[model samples]
Target: MISQYLGIIHPLFPVPSSSVKTGFTTSISAGDKLPQIQILPLLDEVLGVHRVNNRTTHQLTVPPSADDDHAQAWEAFFPEGCINPGNKVAPMGGFGFFMKGPNDFATELGKATSTHVLFNYEVLFESEWEWRKGGKLPGIFGGAGDAAYTCTGGRQSDGKCFNLRLMWRENGKGELYAYLPLTSSNTEHLLSVPPRSIQHPDYGFSVGRGAFTFVPGRWTTIAERIKLNTIGYEDGEIEVFIDGKSVILATGLILRDSTAIESRVRGLHFQTFFGGHAPEWASPKTQRAWFTNVSGAILTDERGIHRDEL
Candidate 1:
């Protein structure tokens, strides 16, 4: 099947592992090469998190380090087919803790510099996760944006942060999209890249849009490179690649006002759930997703954009 879609392979992507080892699958063999990227400041291997729904019976466990490359490799399960009875309107799939500021995401990629962050995502099984309820799609915020978790200091509203999200569209297609939130006073701007063609008076702007077919039960690498816009000028830029394919290349974006605080690459927001305050968005059944090679770094030059050495 992979060879059938050989044309889609990005010239720079490494040959994907024919088989992956997970909690549900066998372990990675010693012969398999581990992901090797140069991240400056690394976060905790055990990403300690605060649960949103303490009563929810979701499970998050780290696989055996000997069986995997990264000691912190994590797998999250969302039951066979369960819904949050307490909050039916918004079903909460377990989420990892949100990391903020330099203390947590303390990297040389300071608040004012342009940087690139990289990570890998794979679905453990075929999960029809998107229910298409409440007008919002069902997915998870695995990447970090410049938004705040609480309404204090740098964080203001839901649309105030810039992050990457893995979403399942209403059609059941997997999507890798960028979510950039900018707000001031009463006006709010929510933007998306790759699906960037969407335009509305209230939804702000969705610029350079593109799509990729996520091969279920396979590994997909995501790389995000962003250059903060110069206030008052549409000079901002964002580029995204899925398995090395350039899915979105957007520019002329006005990210923030001149007086607004500088938004830096904080860390992973790690939000996963069904939302929109509607029943349609609920998971039809319990589903599970796995993530690994979760790492990032600053782009010092052009070579900084490549993935793990093949």
Candidate 2:
């Protein structure tokens, strides 16, 4: 299990479909299986593929291209604007996903020491990754929704949650953010200044064992890994992969401290360019690229790599 998680959870080819519904009335439940990226079809499948389901009076929504992950996800989450006058399909956008069960959910369960939080997600985007707050669970976008659900939810003492989002922007930059619950307060990012202001400081996404890079317009994959065990301070590491090439590495995020933000794993979130509202999360606007085979694995232990490989 650790081998696959530490390494990568690559999808063989096509992903299975998840049967999901709309509205906040129904619950995902422990036994209820789900489709990836919301919607009804394509549930439980790997993300990035596009699908269309125009079952309304107004057909403003257009089915996403079979390969346009970014467009597909973005549209699924915010399908309201993806349509036209009557009930038509809108243009392609991005892709988003929601996982109900733990594909190894217990690995990070419990305290894992001083309030730990982690995040992981993957999606395909189009030319642009937009950042806005129009569509989300009430107050999450700043303009409305519960900020706690979108921001503090990760560090909440509750059970667990996961969110994944894909954005379609006009510029070359698009944004995406995933949340992993940790024990603590969201003061730093929730109460910091610009350039230095960071929201959800207590949360972070993995970059394939804390290293990776994702670019725009290209069909790439993002690998995220998070490990935390500390006292006054928690470690936040991220890695990115652009076109299968390593690109970014950020460490020492300082998300947990006995003096401040410290909590336990509650849930995870995925967003598109959260802007300044999202603390601790520096959503790179330029990461508006496409990715496929969105899968994951968890690694527990390992030995030193062969020095010659270096």
Best by lDDT: 1
Cα miss at 85, model 1 (Å)?
11
Model 1 Cα lDDT, one tens digit per residue, 1-310: 0111122222122223221111011113212332322222123333323333354432435533223443333455554333333364344554444533233334344445443333333233334433443112111222123333432222323434454445444554444344444433212222434343443343333343336545445455554445555556655555555665566555555444444445555544554554323455566666655554444334332322324323
Residue 123 accuracy (lDDT) in model 2? 45
Q: CA RMSD for every model?
A: 8.7, 12.2
Query: For residues 131-231, what per-residue lDDT tens digits would candidate 2 score against the true structure?
Result: 33311210011101132234333343221332322222223332234343343332332222111223434443321221222333344444333333244
Candidate 2 global Cα RMSD: 12.2
Question: What's model 1's lDDT at 199?
Answer: 39
lDDT of each: 0.40, 0.29
In terms of TM-score, the best-performing candidate is 1
Each model's number of backbone clashes? 14, 93
